[model samples]
Target: MRRTHPANMFVCECITQSLFRLMKRKPYNKITVTDLVQEAGVSRNSFYRNYQSTEEIIRQFLEEKTSKWWSEFIAYPDRYPHVISEMFYHFLDMKEEIDLLYRAGLSHLLMEHIVLCGRQSLTGELKGQLQRHQLMKQNVTEDDSYEICY
Candidate 1:
């Protein structure tokens, strides 16, 4: 999702939540824009303004959550072990969404997002910690690190 206005942000969240609710009642592949907008109590235009597809909703939610977690992860002076522990707790905060994805057979979306986030987060600060502690092998790929971390 783009940087939305405060009001449209509300709509985006509403739509996202509604999608999850609908997924609980039906398969993800069975949901549609009409179903989402109706469930969210928003118009089609509102949904279109924020998301192009249902999968985009899940991806965007994961993106926002990942960004928030990364910001907090880097803001503190905690060691890599503590930060890694916190990362699990941080994502546990989204247990509902994660469970819903699994129940809806959309785990691939979560995996894709995690892989992307893992690649992006292996930057200067965290990478240095991994190297210094010998926590990560030099040849470890992004996917390997993601698997290790999770």
Candidate 2:
């Protein structure tokens, strides 16, 4: 039988849950993949297979949680402003993990991912709104400022 990806049920959950619990008690830097694996009763290979590094895990965890909120935000555009506010608050709440990942040399990657996600989401929403207003034309010239404004 083929072994399942550790991320599906065992290793990733263990690592993430352990990290979440430990993060409340101490700084992220103090925690290690070994600690997580030990706490979660897994092996180093399992951790490695699921995550190249601890920073990757941290980024994935943050992204996963944020994606849920993002989905909810998109579902209710009237609460979009509140969603943005909550997003910032969530960032603040994860400051320790963010700081740890940054210190571990993953700051640039994490920031890029965050910015890319935000830009993609915004662009998608704008395109949807334009289409909804019937303002999006199939044959728009690049020189047209009307399309640019939209």
Candidate 3:
């Protein structure tokens, strides 16, 4: 059955919290859907209704965080001067989640999300803006800038 929006969000939040909590105590690879559901106090069917895999959970979390960071990053008028530092600080704020990702051998998902966020920029504005701000003052192409990021 289809869940109401709020109910779905509640289930998602429960599962996410449970996953993070479990990650703190065990290897992510060792945690199964049964473990997650039990920890979340949610039904296995509820977990499956919102996500297909544990990786999807992490991916969704990363996407939400990076997307929010990008939005807030763009809102600052003096963003260019401190963009790099701000980016690092933003990630630092998510250190726990990042640590979990690293411990889980899922660090690649972080890079993937970064690339995805870059691609989502308006008409490559993210790359172009960074280049204009001397991010790649060495005359690197947009594609090359991405390589530098990677």
Candidate 4:
């Protein structure tokens, strides 16, 4: 998610909460500003004040969620070896949200985020491994390490 002012947290949360409710009731293409503001118990001006458009809200939400998954993965560095499988489990846990993103035609965004984070995690892991293994370090240059990881 983009950097939002602390004061606007309430506004964004309200908008997001309302969006989730509405999404459960209808398709993304069918939702509107009126439905948003009404469900959130806020005014149209409030909705417009925080988000440029409905799609922006969903994108920001997904970005935040994607960041969260990466943080969870990174927090346990030892899990890097099992990152792909663990991420698959995490995706299964978030099946509802993933389904919603897919239905909204934003599955590409999720895929891009996962790939970006996964690559970073693997890079970090490989560097750590090479640093800890003196014999491996003597044999493997950084480029070779990357190639091996890839």
Q: Highest TM-score: which candidate?
A: 1
Per-residue C-alpha lDDT of model 4 across residues 80-100, encoded as one tens digit per residue = 445456667766876887788
Ranking by lDDT: 1, 3, 4, 2
Return whichever of 1 and 3 wins on lDDT: 1
RMSD of each: 3.0, 6.3, 3.5, 5.1
Candidate 3, which segments miss by more than 4 Å at Cα? 1-4, 122-142, 145-150
lDDT of 1 by residue, 6-102 (tens): 8888999999999999998989889989999999999999988777789999999998888867766555434445555766687899999899999
Best by lDDT: 1
Better of 1 and 4 by TM-score: 1
Clashes of each: 0, 0, 0, 0
Q: Candidate 2, clashing residue pairs?
A: none
Q: Mind giving the per-residue lDDT tens digits that candidate 2 earns over 40-120?
A: 788888787778777677777877767776676556544444434565776787677677666556578667666655554
Question: Per-model C-alpha lDDT, please?
Answer: 0.77, 0.62, 0.74, 0.67
Model 1's C-alpha root-mean-square deviation from the true structure amounts to: 3.0
TM-scores for candidates 1 onward, in order: 0.80, 0.59, 0.78, 0.66
lDDT of 4 at 16: 89
